[model samples]
Target: MFVRIVKMSFEPSNIDTFLKNFEIKKNDIRNFEGCRFLELYRDKNTTNIFFTYSYWDTEEALDAYRHSDLFKGIWAQTKPLFNDKPQAWSVDKLESLT
Candidate 1:
């Protein structure tokens, strides 16, 4: 499996807007081709910080999602809400307890 994690810090006043946008797209994203899992996480100490942790069947599967129109539209709306450049990583599992 390919794992992707995106860490984002939202503009304080734009956090709600970001959440609303994310809520609207989350389901479609989960249902996208080759998606195995999807989740959203928040930083306990930083209310405006969030992360998306997802699993794809392969790097190519993730690339397909990134190239889709759904991604283009959602990302256009999402990009301006960031307080900082987002951090992301694509990796394969070394080991997992579960």
Candidate 2:
């Protein structure tokens, strides 16, 4: 499996709006085909920063989701709320302790 991690920095005032939208769309994202898992993490010291950790079956699966309407809608709502450009990483899982 592969993991996708996205780091997002949001405008302080837009955090709540982003969270609400994420809550509404989380289920759909987790249930998307080839999505093995999904998680969201907020930086402990930086309230405006967040990360999305997700597992996918393959790179093609991820690309499919990226091109879907669901992603488009979600991005449209999300992109405008960011204070800085989002950063993402796609990597193969090398180990898991648990």
Candidate 3:
């Protein structure tokens, strides 16, 4: 499985708006093809900092989602709220303790 993590830092005032958008779109995103899991996390010490954790069947699957209309819409709405360039990483799981 491919594990993807995206760390995003939003302008302080835009954090609530971003979370609202995510709350509205989370289900749709999670239902996308090859999306095995999806979640959002916030830094306890920094409310404007967030991360998205997800799993995909493969890199191709993730790329497909990235190009989907769902992503285009959500991303376009969210992009302007960034306080800095987002960081993303993809990992291949060697083993899982669980």
lDDT of each: 0.95, 0.98, 0.95
Tens-place lDDT digits, model 3, residues 1-98: 88999999999999889989999999999999999999899999998999999999989999999999999999999999999999999988788896
What is the C-alpha lDDT profile of model 1 across 1-98, one tens digit per residue? 98999999999999999989989999999999999899999999999999999999989999999999999999999999998999999988889895
Error of 3 at 88 (Å): 0.3
lDDT of 1 at 21: 91
Task: Rank the candidate models, highest lDDT first.
Answer: 2, 3, 1
lDDT of 2 by residue, 1-98 (tens): 89999999999999999999999999999999999999999999999999999999989999999999999999999999999999999989999997
Q: Is candidate 2 or candidate 3 better by lDDT?
A: 2
* Residue 54 alpha-carbon offset, candidate 3, angstroms: 0.2
Question: Which one is best on lDDT?
Answer: 2
Model 1: per-residue Cα lDDT at residue 80: 93
- Model 1, runs deviating above 4 Å: none
Q: Pairs clashing in candidate 1?
A: none
lDDT at residue 12 of model 1 (Cα atoms):
91
TM-score of 1: 0.95
Model 1 — which ten-residue stretch has the worst lDDT? 89-98
Better of 1 and 2 by lDDT: 2
> Any idea how many clashes model 1 has?
0
- By TM-score, how accurate is candidate 2? 0.98
For each candidate in turn, the TM-score is 0.95, 0.98, 0.95
